[model samples]
Target: MAHLSSRRRHSRSPLKAFAAVAVVCAVAAGGAYAAGVGPFDRGSDAPAPAAADQARAFLADWSGGHYDRAAARTTNPSRARDVLRSFTAGLDIGKPRLTAAAAERTAGDRVRVAFTAKMPVTGLGTWVYKSHVPLQEQANGSWKVDWSLGLVHPHLSEKEKFRLERQDTAVPQVEDRNGKALTGKAYPSLQPLLAQFTDGGGRPRGSILLVDRVTGETKRTETTFGRQAGKGGEAGDAPVKTTLDAAWQSAADRALESGADGRNASLVALRVDNGEILAMANTPATGFNRAVSGTYAPGSTWKIVTSSALLLKNAVTPDTVVDCPKHLIVGKEFHNVETSEFRGATFQKDFTESCNTAFISLRGKLGGSELGDVARTYFGVGQEWHIGIPSYDGSVPRPADETEKAASMIGQGRIQANPLIMASVTATAASGRFHQPTIVLGSKDGTSTTPLPAAVVGRLRTMMRATVTGGTAHVLADLPGEIGAKTGTAEVAEGEENNGWLVAQRGNVAVACVVEQGVTGGGSAGPILHNLLSSVPGDPS
Candidate 1:
């Protein structure tokens, strides 16, 4: 009878068979649930209720930064976790939360999930972005999220990553002393502080999504890192007022770029009376600021300091006759440029002509520390300066031997200076006193030496004037300004070309320039100085 019943049941219609199977399944499920081993139990083989449900759970874990758990629910767990960590590293966004999610069925056993994420940005209020997550039914009958960069951000590609970085505040406009804007768009180097807030390629790490203080709408998005955040901020901050003169800056920029002729060059100008920076420019617009930070031999420019020491000691006067020779032997042989010597010329003539051997002959009259002392006191060499930026204070070490002393007198050997230091030296001669050069207003003032004697300064001015009128800087004599200048060709190697230098004072502006691998100061750097000085407005004469 039992066998007959079983046969009858098996022969029943499909609907009856299905009904019996359902009853068996329900009973088994109930028993498993009582034992905490049903489909919903941990590690159950049963699939998720829906693709949407699985996606939402994964998003919840991801949004909360539970990357391990979230990645485990993705098809590529290890790779997804690594990418997630990389994207979030250094990200400064607030705790992320899903604001909304919507799921739509795509192809068979696949679902597309679109969601909105909301997170707070530092100093930028709230940020919102959309993400798309795709879910597919796995071979195990469970739904797993298909990992992709788009899962992090829709705009991201497979090779890209998403991050919530701190946006640079809008940089304030940098203005000159006369309140004219020094636009980076016009001259990229004018943005001195830009590098502090940008990547290597000059791209801002973050952008400021500026909102109207009155209206809730976004005013604009700025990518520049300017003085908005203390000169390195985004665009909305107050304009940074600098001591730079825009016209002079433009002229300097032009002169340096064109005059360099493919060589590295830099120029810096300052007001003689107060040491306010008028212009600072460099060729090639490189990140390394050669104007202030460069260290090189001043060549004959060191004669300015040597002459100051001699004048202070009354060792020689402008009219005092000195012997000029083709060569002089101290510890080492020193010779004049081109072996052209001016025999029995006045000290003033020697200076104007830049007689290297003539200046070296005066070393016997100087004390061991005289040159260094004069350099520090009168020219501010080796003095610490705070110019609101990086800079090098020139070094004039006390010479240890006759060779070093002779070389030091001619701005060579161990002597080192930059365009800024040389410019300040000229400014001192122009003003009869020393004032540290400054680029930013209200910068800390460095110590100044005692004022030069009226007689010493008067003679120094006369010598410099002779330089323009009949000496190495004769090219600048016809310039409209009452100019006094010095030219230098610093020998860098035994046979290689020398570094050219020029320091000049026109009206109240003192300027200095240097060209690497240039053969002569007058030939390479004189025209540049003249171009810059000629561009100045008003009659300097």
Candidate 2:
């Protein structure tokens, strides 16, 4: 292994070899002249109190991270400063303690000073090593070190570096709201989420490495956090506490599996008042965490957000007359699911039916950015949300044209959301206030929204109630509480089946679910939600 290092650093190619030699010589190594000594006037012609004092001063500066001052005491100040800086930064080792040992004045005017360096490698004990510094009296009557990279480390050659790498990594522990252990086996829907934690935080310990700079090959393990795992493996990183309710999660897990009709589906339930995620479940249970991360065209369930913007602007009322035509076109043709049309329908009726043409007809009522601003300001869409883990905050891109704007008004044309976002939307609409959804405890809330006008919120809630009572989302009407909801059937690419979506609020629990290829939000997603929501006792608040 000693053969790996050399007095003269070599490169893989001749040109680089020449470059390496030039770099090494720039550090004043030429003064050593292979014999570790140089020709100079004897001490009889020089007046030096102690050459060893200069060595101790340089060591003092280097130990205190004063590389510039220390380099000034070296023969080649510029090159010594660069190598010294690189040596400290490259290793990321914390402050070191340097002590000057015995100093020997050779038979000439030169003196050799030996020193011990104690470096504290992170996660490991201190590492001590001994090295010698050659000092020569400059023509200006000052002692300067014949500085070289080798002075930084005895075997340090050109293009060599040090780094600290973990030997054993951290293990993530996910806990329920009350701090009880929650494993993937207990909640199968959390398998994908657990995989993220596991991949990031593995075992618990580490190592520092000496490696080749150009070709990142490890030369040796300089030090380690521990030879065997110690107390580090006990707790790993702090336990990640979630807002999930075990009973509710169990119900959600069951309902999604049983009612998804064996198709891909996801569901999320949140507290309307506080925005704590109560339950999140996905069908198949072991693959993607679609409930929080999957992006889908929200279909008509997005009407909750659109309605808020319009109501805030006083553009329409629940009883406002509107015409729902078979198809409406701006840049492209737009129609309700199955091209359903209702002439002379009330705004509430259009909402209950999830009328695409009806909403598209009102695109001129607001500015291009108004809808997106309303979503972000009032619903936390497109805002940074530290939900205790990685999450995709919903994005509402500014529409490029009237067609895109109209499509966005109806939750299509590049609008994307997941069950977590839609569930939060429903919770906000139901409670007339926005509380950023949080699964993990102590997560940050989204930017505050202006209070939703009570009259407008009343109307929105009325419309959602009507949806469950006598409209498309009537599938959930028979549930044992005042369940208000809106359904959506979002179109996919030309040939794919539309995704079904529904968001419902019963008591203080706001729930949202999506079913792929389910055709209509009311028919496919509603029943599943009914089963899940019904299973849990209604929130008293």
Candidate 3:
């Protein structure tokens, strides 16, 4: 590319070519005449110490009206004559008066010289400009402009050098009670979301809703990317603070990590006093939300919903006795599970062990739609709703025959529920009345409670307690609080494989855990609940 001086070549149109030549000729004639006058006539003027020094002196003399004097000092007289030629080549100076000048020597065998040039005219102000001349000493010991001023430097210090680096920012932290980071240390799978927070330039924000047993509130706190955004606002840019006890949340996270052989697990914990989720988590190894979303036969857990219907209609009491034989003949088919029979057990006892036969018999006596109404109106089923996260609308089969009614009675046939909804149902038994589950803290401004009789909750609690103590959920017998629980293992269509679920509550904390295609709810799912409860504080009383 051409340097700055070459840019002037475009400005010098063909029309102005002769005028420039006339100016050069006039200046040359004057300079030549002065050279003849011998401006510097010192006979003993020896050669300068260095070629660079000679170039500097030449520049100074030329700017002081001593053109011939400067030419004489050059080590090479021929090269010095050329310097004078180029200087006058662009000027119309008729014995031009010199102005000011400065010179410096660089590391290389090159000299930098600067000068101010001025032309005096009557009407125009003094037109002043600065010039940087780069001079290269030739083998003949004289100098010539290496290129142009724009190519080199006018000021000796005007030089620089420029480069680019990648630094990593801190990942967002999930902490425990002792201020320890749970996600990074124990749950590495969560690292991606933390990394996303940093990589996304601190715009990440979300909210976590947790349970409050004391006043029936689902506490909500916003989460943000950085410290400032974590404060929360209308833009929702704030660090989320959840009702989740970080320690309990850690335990839940840890327990879900069990069965490392890629079996998916999901868990949800709530406060029984008012339905507030303490911890809701899922192992998305397969990107499936089985906890609050898996809709399947709730199996034996539906027995509670059925028992609720029987109690509400006065069709059965906690003390009402029934026989649970290994199989109940519904039409021509047989219906049963591991211990389908409870011999002669009360309604509460039959419920504790999850006897399908006893409930199947109860359904025939009560009729199907009666159970369906309780399931739909009291429990959430076949409904679109919000309960923190999206959920699968639990269902109750509208049975067309005795066989379907028998199956529906035992949480089979067309009935379905995600673990989250079941937890809500279990919490209702613990609390006496049902309260809508919330993921945020808000007053019930105009909302009212559904008045379920205290008698219903009292009996349901007894049945759940019996399950934990002497029945199928005996696995939770020694849990750290007054534990009430129920277990379920439902057979999936086309296979003997079943989905296991265990839901329980201790004082204020209620929990539901699910293991897909597992042995039984009392096996895999119960242990997960136990591990999670073991991490909670103060025995939940």
lDDT of 1 by residue, 1-541 (tens): 0000111211211011111101010010011011111133223333334666667667656644567878998999999898776654434443344533445656777777776765433223234677777889888788899888778766555433343435433454567788887786676556554332222112233543444434545545523231334455344345666678877888888888778899878889888888888888877676556677666677787677788899999999999999888777776566766767888899999899898888888888998668878888877777777665545676565565676777778887556678888999998987789998877677787676888888888888889999999999898989875788899977664334667888998778889998876778998899898888877855222
Could you estimate the TM-score for every candidate? 0.62, 0.63, 0.56
lDDT of 3 by residue, 339-417 (tens): 3456778888778877767777777567646766676576544444434223344545356566667767777654556
Order the candidates by lDDT, highest first.
Answer: 2, 1, 3
Total backbone collisions, model 3? 11
lDDT of each: 0.67, 0.70, 0.54
| Error at 166, model 1, angstroms | 14
Rank order (by TM-score, best first): 2, 1, 3
Collision count for each candidate, in order: 12, 5, 11
Winner of 1 and 2 under TM-score: 2
- Tell me the lDDT of model 3 at 73: 60
Off by over 4 Å in 3: 1-236, 259-261, 284-286, 441-449, 539-541
Q: RMSD of model 1, in Å?
A: 28.6
Error of 2 at 30 (Å): 60
* Model 3 worst lDDT run, 10 consecutive residues: 1-10
